[model samples]
Target: MTTAPTRFAPSGPLTGTVSVPGDKSISHRSLMLSALAVGESRITGLLEGEDVLATAAAMRAMGADILRGDDGVWTVHGVGVGGLMQPGQALDMGNSGTSTRLLMGLVASHAITCTFTGDASLSHRPMGRVIEPLSAMGADVSASPGGRLPLMVRGLAPAVPLEYRLPVASAQVKSAVLLAGLNIPGVTRVIEPVATRDHSERMLKGFGADISVETDADGARIISITGEAELKPQTIAVPGDPSSAAFPIVAALIVPGSDVTLTGIGMNPTRAGLIGVLRDMGGDIETLDEREVGGEPVADLRVRHSALSGIDVPPDIAPSMIDEFPVLFVAAAFAKGTTRTSGLDELRVKESDRIAVMAAGLAEIGAQVEEAEDGLTIIGTSGDMLPGSAHPIASSLDHRIAMSFAVAGLHCRDGASVDDMHPVQTSFPTFEPMLRGLAEA
Candidate 1:
């Protein structure tokens, strides 16, 4: 596959209503959980992107029969609980840390020996966070140096389930431990000091897994899932990805006289903090037709251009919207005053070093931004556009950074470009096209 450079220039006000792709996180869990259930599971609005495709392929390698209909519906026949066979080849997870970590958990207690591999980016991510707890549960896992990928696992069915306290705030790590416990005969518990997305737990329960959550002192969440549990096949209607909808939402906020309506955006409280943060910054965002879908909150957002002002972001909200920071930084650029964010140590370890990349790119665009070890301090432009420099930002093959600056360029005077837009296929394949369509106001 050839890597391509892409650029975006100043555009007209965005005025339209559009639906984004399916939630990548939910889509991954849908496929995984659906593949774990007996009988047939039907899923609509599944994200047809590279990363989720990797998850689909990995499940297929494990003997789940997954097929797509002419109308884009997915029908999957799961191998059922504890029925996974040892794959003949290594599972290749292409540039998806979510797939790699979560599936590692699924494979942990299956009595199957599986080799897990990935592309260059996913290969570099540390698997130790998952390995530590899964190892404690008696799954035999071995990784490359520094506990990275190209790893292998020999699972022990009926693996021991243990109580885990998260040392960090990662939904992926939390979900991994829970997914691994699905085959164990007892309670599998994860105590999170910082709450992350609860998609896995929510979806697991929807599939008929016995799971419950309780809040402890200090507001930590204790999620317990009972395993040796059967997950009934479900017909899931996946909502639009809030993360994918974020680009257009922010674009509408920063672009002058713009009003864009995004429908079917997931509003799960744990994952919808970005809306609250942006609202606090004086963004003219409205939520209408709020309702429930597939056990998660869903809503339509009508975002109109407003005069944004920067403020201190609550550190506790970091886990809720970790993936939205790159675009949030772009919004910070177009706001007034300084936007200060902390408690983002995890940003350093995402698909790219988001902190360093965002700070550097903002500086390149003539935005006054300061980078810290864990966070950033961005002095906003007070409604003025950044000086888009001649050089293109090096996207580092991360999809969010590439798409974020593309949104920033919509408001910048000189426009901006990215080193590689190909990575956008990982999460939001329709990003460039959707953005272009939105420009037709």
Candidate 2:
């Protein structure tokens, strides 16, 4: 497929009811844990985007019988815990860091050697965080000097379980360690300074693993899992991604005279920090038709345009909305006053340096942004034209960065232009079309 560059021009109010793609995080985890389960696990509402499809393909390469039914449901006949065969070739993970890193944990304990590779963007992300922990647990992992991708992992049989304390708040690193422990002989424990998303823990328990979480006096969470539990397959229905819904939700809140209803969105508290920040910014968003879906909270979000004010975002909330900083920066650009955000070191290690990318993009578009060691502070323009001349923002092929800036352009003085929108396919392939549809509506 050829790469394409696209630009967004300033637009009017966006109005519509739309369903975003299935939760990318949950979609990836469901396929992986289900593939490690004992029987046929049926899943509906899985994201078919390139990143997730790459994960499904990786699972198949690991000997899981994964297929899509004629009715469009996905079914996985897993080889069960410890039953995965040595893959015959390198697992091409495409642009999915979630797949590559999480699968690394799973592959680390088996008696096999699997080489993992990805596209240029993924190749640049640091994999050493995962490698360090897994290596300590007896896995032989070798990577480029900077711990980048295109690495080889030699699994160890009867691997020793480990007790690790996370220096950074990352669900990916925690999930990787826990997955590796599944094939080890003893209990594996991980202590997190700040609680990251718990989808992996929840899904692991649903698949019948022996895992427990406890909160200490210092507010740290210690997760312990006993290895070698038999996993039983169950049907799964993935909730709509809150991360994906964030775009339209913010659009409705920022665009004058706009109202929208986003349905079946995951409201897992860890991922709902965006909603909290938006509400505090005085956005008129409400939750209706609330219920549970597939072990997750789901709700229909109704948002209407409202005057927004900036507020300080606590560092503690960083983990819940780590993927949302870029979009939040967009919202901050249009709000009144200044918004301060901290505890964002994790943002630097994502698909791109999100903090740096957003700072540069926001600065180019007229928002006064200051980049700090761990976060950024934005002085809003209150919907005014950017003071300086405008220029196109470089996306570096980061899908979230591209989409966030596109949304920002909607409210910019001179609509923003982004280079290389082709990377949007890695997650939300329908993003541009969906945004266009909203404009037409």
Candidate 3:
């Protein structure tokens, strides 16, 4: 067990031009899809964090020839569709749900069985969502009680296609089903009630998959993909993660007289809802040099400290910014009035119960917060000092929760501290240094 911990203390404002790491979701997909493509695929700006690296290693173990060039490029030689070999050892996914769930999809369509495990935190996360859909497609999955991890998946060759309607808005679940569809015989379809991040769809299409998306009358999306299409090698460039950019952005917003520009951020409409909420609260934000990078939108974000007012965030927008709710709560704490976020039942199933965790932490820091069944409402102190007489927050080994409250500490009267930061390495190993550099600048 890792025991070291770090605390973030920001005394003054933050200012600088900084670029965060590659998009985690895209990075994972890039490696996995590239490993299934024929011939050599090159990837630049891929996230080298632990989670993505774990996926890269898993692909290598499954017979893909993956290498990192001196120029920081990743090259993968795939085994083609229905060609993945059984891994000799158990695949340890660490703390990445994206890796674990998506990999299950890939394994489910092959004629092999694999055992998967993870860290303590990841082992407790729910896998039933992905397992249920894959099971419907003829794969056999067995897990611990309550659908927890440390599970085994027996793949089915020429698996049956499935038309699944998602009960929850989760990119991981959607991506898992799509991955399984790759080796199935016919079209695999998924209907999503509200749009989640479409990185999987976008990346799958980029790899030459026969995929199409159409909107239904009720605003749901019908995504269909023809199974067993040959994926050709393609060059990929991953963009900076907006979720990681949220910490510094929020820190810049609440700190007095702060101005910072984040360059080359992925501006996918589905994942840019944090910017929307910030703008709705009257934040001083600007998008400069908007352009497309690797089939996704990219931009330089200029953020300056401004007085913010709270507003009701509609539940419909939850799918667009699901991973960012923790930091959004921090921004709400410094805004005037109450910021209520609903339709966030998804937060309960993440690495941690984010709604409960954030509500507890915020209340400990002297903010007025109320927890709901699906979401939470936070009443901003409007720059009022958060009294930190309470104990430091335990991150529960969740990377986003650890980083979110660390940013919140900057604007709090007593500056918050978190118990475990090891999980941050799973997504953003550079988070501490990047945040510290911004503080010094």
Candidate number of the best TM-score: 1
lDDT of 2 by residue, 1-441 (tens): 655456676577788888999999999999998999988999998988899999998889989999998888999999988988888899999989999999999999999899999998899999988999999999999897799879999999788899999988889999999999998888999999888999999899889899999999999999999998789998999999999898888777777778888899999998899999999899998999999987899999999988889999998998899998889988888889999999899888888999998898888877889999888999886755453324668897799999998887777666778877878888888898888888889
Residue-wise lDDT of candidate 3 within 1-441, one digit each (tens)? 666555565578899999999999999999999999999999999999999998998998899999999999999999998999999999999988899999999999999899999998899899999999999999999998888889999999989999999998888899999999999989999999889999999989999999999999999999999999899999999999999998888889988889999999999999999999899998989999999987999999999998889899999998888999999998898898999989898898889999999998888778899999999899997866576533668888899999988888887777788888888998888998888888888
Query: Once superposed on the true structure, which residue ranges of model 2 sit more than 4 Å away at CA?
Result: 1-4, 385-391
Report the poorest 10 consecutive residues by lDDT, candidate 3. 383-392
Which residue pairs show backbone clashes in model 1? none
* Residue 306 error, candidate 2, Å: 1.5
TM-score rank, highest first? 1, 3, 2
Global Cα lDDT for candidate 2? 0.88
Per-model TM values vs. the true structure: 0.99, 0.97, 0.98
Name the candidate that leads on lDDT: 1
Candidate 1: regions farther than 4 A off = none
Q: What is the C-alpha lDDT of each candidate?
A: 0.92, 0.88, 0.91
Q: Give the root-mean-square deviation of each candidate in angstroms.
A: 0.9, 1.6, 1.2
Global lDDT of model 1? 0.92
